[model samples]
Each structure stands twice: as structure tokens, then as C-alpha cells.
Target: MTIRVLIVDDSKTMQAVLRARLSREADIEVVATAGNAAEARQLMRELDPDVVTLDIEMPGMNGLDFLEKIMRLRPTPVIVVSSAAQAGTESAARALALGAVDCYAKADRFGAMGTEDNGKLASLIRQAAQIRFDQRAPSIPKVSVKTQKSIGGDTRLIAIGSSTGGVEALQILLRDFPADCPPTMIVQHINVNFAAAVARRLDSICKAKVLLAEPDMPIRRGQVYFAPGGDRHMMLGGTENWFVKLRQGDLVSGHRPSVDALFRSIAPKIRGHVVGVLMTGMGSDGARGLLEMAQAGATTIAQNEASCTVFGMPRAAIELGAAGVVAPLDRIAEHALSRAA
Candidate 1:
């Protein structure tokens, strides 16, 4: 099916450029373009496009405000198209929390992104088009610190992998963690520019202290580490004393900081002492590695399809027989904590 899209940007040039770029895709059709929220709102009501590509910066009503209105009122799938500056700001993180499927960072001022970037955007648009907001699970009550079971001494580490809807998923999962949760590491596929902003956002909502992982940083309880998005892959390192190790490498499983790399790195070293979670994402990056982790006797979990924003990664893992437990998004944290306990 052709994916119908609405482009909402203040600049006519950007709208034209996006139109031209997307026109190259055979299965995507730009149904309409809107200069601002007012135009977009009206066009949305009439056209009812399958997806909306939105810009964060707009004149009358900002893209974020408009996005909030859309999600609250209409619930169409939205993807935020942001400049470099906007991508690095908290506004980008807020866009994800507000229900945008993904954030596409513009390459330059004129929106002259390369062919590969355009293809990525096309793929994202296709995924976003498939989203059904009505299928979303109800919010889960967070397990209070006082009620959580004591962390078993045998469970020393927790590692998580996510992409696509991960910014929101991570926030929800981490909110259930106690202040003194186990040593945890996360690899969420994201733009390098938005990594720090996402970390700050997660830090604010979570009870555990979240930090961008650094080379040789020792993993410790009560602290959560995120692989800072860039050229290097974050690995669980050291023989006896586990620490973060960043290694330069080509893209593995179509990602530089690949989830497979992180999961495979820890599988042999930590064995049953670790809990590995593969959450919502678009590809099979973590499937094989998750299988290896399960083979190494680690407790493994995957987010259930019904609750996933995009069920690709977890579906792949489940098919590979890697996930020992497949739980809904809201119950994932509870299962992880229970297995650890």
C-alpha cells in the first residue's frame, strides 16, 4: 500500500525538498504540505494522511505544541523532522515522549540529505504508517522501592537494547526501577546529536542516576549507563571487574553501536549473572546476540508484540528462540526484576 504523508514545515523550500526527496520512493506519496499548524490541522482533517512529517520550529504555534494537539485529538502517526540544533535540544526528546515514531535529522540548511539518509527516512515513514495508536497498552503501575523484592546477590548486571520507540520505552521501563537498582547498561539506537539530550531526559524521570557511558567506566549498582551514540561500539569489558569499553568498528547488523555487539560482548563474561532485555525496534540487530546470551545461561526477555511500538526486533528475537520470556511492555520490568530476584 502507498503510504500517504503530510509534510508540515514553515519553509516552502524545505517542504519542496522533502517532497522531491520522497518522490523518489515508489511506495510513498506526499499527499499534502502545510506551512504551519493551522494549515496542517485543516489539511489533516480533510486529507487524513497516514503519516505526518513535522518540524519542531514553527512560527505561530511551535511543532511541539501542534504535536501535542495532534496526539491528544487525532492520534495520527508523526515523525519529527528536526535541524541539528533542535535535535540536540530537550525539545527533540520531548517530541518522542509526545508520541512521534522517530526523529529525522536534516543533513544541512537546504535539506540536501544524501541518498542513504533519504532511504532511511522513507523506511521510517513506512514503519510509522503502520502504527495503530488504539493498540497501545495501558500504563503500568510502577513497583515502589518499598515493595520490590531484594536483589539477589547472583544477579549482578542488567543490559538493555532498544531502537525506534526506545526513547519513550526506556523512560517507562526505568521509572519502575528502584533508586539502588542493579548495574545497568543500555544501547538505544539514536542520532548522535540527540544522545545527550535523551540521557538527560531519562535521568530526570528515573530513580537511578543515568550517565553516558565512557571508556573504562566501571559498572556499579544504582547507576545506569547509556552508550553515547557515535562511531564506537560500547562493550561490556574486563575479566573480573566489568567496565565499559568503547571500540572502533564498522556497522554491525546495520548499526555502529550495535545491540548485538553489546549483548554478545557480555554473554560469555557474565553468563547467568546478567539479565538481557531486547525491547521495541525496527531490525534484527539484537536477535543473534540475545540467542548467545541465552545459550550462556543468562535470563533473557523480549517486549511482547502487542505492546511494542514497532515489533521488529523483539519478533526476530522470539523467532530465534532467544527470549526466555516474552512479556508485554508494562510487565517487562516486573519480569526482569522477578527473574533477578
Candidate 2:
């Protein structure tokens, strides 16, 4: 089946460029283009495109506001396409929090354009079209937390991995934890430009300190580390207390920051002291690694289908018999705390 797409950008040049880029794929059809949110709303009603590629800095109604409206009214899968500049980073992050399924950086400005962009764009379109749209619910503002308790001295480590719809899923799961939550490491599949923005956004919503993980950095309690670099897999290293270690390796299961790679490494290193959680995301990047963690006696949990944005990763883990318990996104934090407690 052809994947229908709608391009929503204020710039006529950008719309043309995106159309040209996406046109190369035989399975993709650019059904319509809208210069602003008002036009987008009308086309959305008329064209009924399978997916939408949205730009953040549109005139009049901005992308974030429009996205919020779409999530509330239409509930379609959206891929945020934005500039890599600082302001674009902030807006793109907000769009993701508002319920965009994925995000991509525009390639023309960087002067490193390639077929890879076309391939990725096409893949995103196909993936978005397959997403169960009505399953999406409106995003609620993050709740405020009064105080956070640091993980107890006996708590060893926390590891997580996600892809596809993971950006919003991770935010919701992390928002409820106390500031002193376990020393957590996350491997979220995302483009390089958006990784920092994701970390910053999570830091604002969660009580625990959140920052992009760097090689050789010491892991500290009450801090959460994210793999900022997407081309490498993040692992734990060091003698006294394991810290973040980034390494370039073959793409295992089609992802660089493969959840399996991180979880497999943590299984033997942290062993019984670790808590491993697999949230909503597409594909099976973390299934086998989660199983390895379960074998090593670490507590393993999968987000149940009811709360998952995409049920692929968690379902794969459950099928592999990796998860010790399958709980909804709202209950994951309390469950993790219980294991650590």
C-alpha cells in the first residue's frame, strides 16, 4: 500500500524540497502541502494523509500548538522535521512532548545531504502509517513533585532503552520519580540534534538530575544519564562505581544504541543489583538483552500495552520471557522503587 504524506511548512522552498526528496520512493505519495496550520487543518480534513511531516517555525499557528490541536482532535502520527539550530532544538523537543511520534533534522542546511535522508524519511513515513492512530491519547502536562528521595545505598543501577514513540514515553515514566531516584542510564533511539533537547526536557520534568551521558563520566546517585551520541552504544565501565562508556560497534538489531547491547552489558556487570525496564518503542532492540538481564537475576519490567505508545519493544521482551512483571507506564516508577527498596 502507498504511504500518503502531507508536508506542513511555511516555507514554499522547504515544502518543494521535501516533496522532491520523498518523491523518489515509489511507495510514498505526497498527497498535499500546507503553508500554515490553517491550511494544514483544511488539508487534513480533505486529503486524509496517512502521516504528516511538520515544521516547527510556521507562521501564525506554530507547529507545537498545531500539534497539540491535532493530538486532541485528529490523533494522527506525526514526524517533526526541524532545523538543527538551538531554537529549533527547543521547539522540536516541545513538539515531541506534545505527542509527535518521531523527529528528524533538516539536512540541506548542514551541507551533508545524502540518500540516507531520503531512505530515513521514507522509512518514517511507512512506520507512521502503520501506527494504530486511535490508540493515541492526548498528552497531559507533567505533574509537579514536592520532594524526591534518592535511591537507597543498596540500589546499584537502573537501565532503560526505547525507540519510535519512546521520547514521550520516557518523559512520562521519568516524571514521577523522586529527585533521588536510582542512577539511571537510558538508551533512546533518536537523532543527534534532538538528544540534548530530550535530556534538557526530561531534566525539567523529573526530580532526578538528567544529562546526556559522556564517555568515562562517573555515575552518581540521584542522576540520570542519557546516551547523547546515537552512533555509539552506551555501556557501563569502571572498577569502584560503573560509569557511562560509549563505544562504536556494529548496529545490533538495526540500532546503534541497541537496548540489547546496554542490557546485556549490565546483566553481568551490575548483576542482581540492577533494575531493567523496557518501555514503548518500535522493533526488538532490547528483547534479548532484557532476557539476559532476567537471567542474571536483575529485576525486569515491561510497560503493558495499555500505556505504551508503541507496543513493539515491550511485546518482544514479553514474548522472549524477559520481563519479570508487565505493568503500565504509570506504575513502572513505583514498581522500580519497590524492587530497589
Candidate 3:
């Protein structure tokens, strides 16, 4: 099915560029474009597009305000467009909290690398379009490396990868963790610019300290590190003394700070000392990596579909025979802790 999309941004240039970019897709169609909430509201009613790419810094009613109204009334899948700025970061956070499916970050001047930028934009548009309209917030609801023996003795490291419904899932999973929980790290697919915001948000609610992963940062027990979501992958080193090393380069498993990168990194370094969890997401980014972790003697789990907002990632892992156990979102924490400790 062709995915119909509406573009809502104050800038005509951005609108034109987005239009040209989205036009590159064979399945995504630009149903309409609007400059303000008023126009967008009208177009939304008339066009009934499957998805909407909304700019948070709009003229009249801001994107957050309109997003609230849309969620309450229209309920279309909305991906927010934000600038690569501090304000944009905050706004993107607010947009996500308000139920925006995802966010897109644009450089200050949108045309520095027009063609390349558009290609990225085209990918976002296509992904945004694939989100099913029935997908809703439930309020906190890989690798072919090997098959290892059931080596169990207190999990030393825990790594998780998620997307789509990850923020809420992480919140639910981490809230109950005691201060002495195993050193943990997560790669949640989100806008690169908003990674810090998410870390801060999670820090406020988690019993464990949640901080953004830094280069050469030591992995400490009871503290959770989040992968910075931009151009780098978070890697693990050191067998006895664990540390995080952020590497900037190509996207691994289709993401920087990818779950696969984090998982596979730890596999060879610390056998039987890790537990990997692949949760809700839209693709197969972490499947093979999780397999590597499991085969290296680490316990691995995939969140079950019943509790997942989107079952893509977990499903993929299960399909690849990667997960040692499949569990519901709520039960995952308990299962991990039991296996880890």
C-alpha cells in the first residue's frame, strides 16, 4: 500500500526539499503540504494522509501544541522535524513525550549537502510512512555469531537495544532495578540530537544512574549508560574492567550506537558475563549481534509481541533463533535480573 504523507512546516524551502526527497520513494506519496496548524488541520481532515512530517518551530500554533491536539483528536502518525539546535532538542523531546512517532533533525542551513541530506530525508519519510496507524503508545509497554552453552554465574554486563516504543519500555524496565543492578547500557534508536534529553529523562526515573556514554568511560555497576544517537557506535573493551569506547564511522546494523555494535563488542571480550536484551523496534538491527552474545555464553532475551508496541526487532531476533528466551516487556526485567544475578 502506498503511504500517504502530509508535510507541515513553516519554511517553503524545507517543504520543497522534503517534497523532492519524499518524491524519490516509490511507495511514499506527498498528499499535501501546509505551513501552519490551521492549514494542516484542514488538510489533515481533507486528505486523511497516513503520516505527517511536522516541524516543531512553526509560525502560529507550535508543533507541540498541534501535536497534542492531533493525538487527542486525529491520531495520525506524526514525525517531528527539528533543527540541530538546543531549542530543537528540547522541542523534539517534548514532541516525543506528546506522542510523536519520531523526530528528524535538520542542519541550521538545510542546503549544505542538499542531495545527501535529501537522501537521508527520503529514508526518514519512507520509514515514517511504514508506521501503522494502529500503532499507539501503551504507556511504557542478533547476530548469527554462535550458539553457546548454558553458562550461568551472575551476569556482569547487560546490554539492550530498542526503537519505536523503547523510551517507555526502558522506563518500565529500569524503574524497578535496584541501585546495585549490573552495569548496563542501551542503544535506543532516536534522533541523534535528542539522546541527551532521553538520558536525562530516564535518569530522573531510574534507580540506577542513567548517563550518556562517553569515550573511554568505565562501566560501573549500578549505573546505566545510553549510547549517543548520532554518527558513532558504542563499543565495549576490557574483559575484567569494562569500558565504553565511542567510535564514529559507518552505521552498523543500520544505526550508530547500534545495539549490534554494543552486543558484538562485548561478546568476544567477556564470555558468559553478559546478558543481552533485544526489545521493541521496527527492524532487525540487533538480531545477529544478540546471537553472538548468546553463543558467547551470555543469556539473551527478546521481548514478546503482546507487550511490545511494535514487534519487528524482537520478532526478527526470534526468527533468527537468536533469543534464548522470549518474554513479555514487564517480565523481561525480572527475567534479566534473575539470570544476571
Clash numbers, per candidate = 0, 2, 11
TM-score of every model versus the real structure = 0.92, 0.93, 0.84
Q: What is the C-alpha RMSD of each candidate to the true structure, in Å?
A: 2.4, 2.5, 5.7
Whichever of 1 and 3 has more lDDT, that candidate is 1
Off by over 4 Å in 3: 24-26, 59-61, 72-74, 108-116, 133-154, 271-273
Predicted structure with the largest lDDT when compared to the true one: 1
lDDT of 1 by residue, 167-278 (tens): 8788888988877888899999987777888888899998889998889999898899998988999999997888999999999999979999999999889744788999
lDDT of 3 by residue, 154-268 (tens): 6688899998767767877787666677889899998777989878878887777999989989988888999887788888877778898888888887777688888889888
Quote the RMSD, in angstroms, for model 1. Answer: 2.4
Q: Give me the displacement of residue 270 in model 1, in angstroms.
A: 1.6
31-64: candidate 2 lDDT, tens digit per residue: 9999999999999999988999999888899999
Candidate 2 or 1, higher TM-score: 2
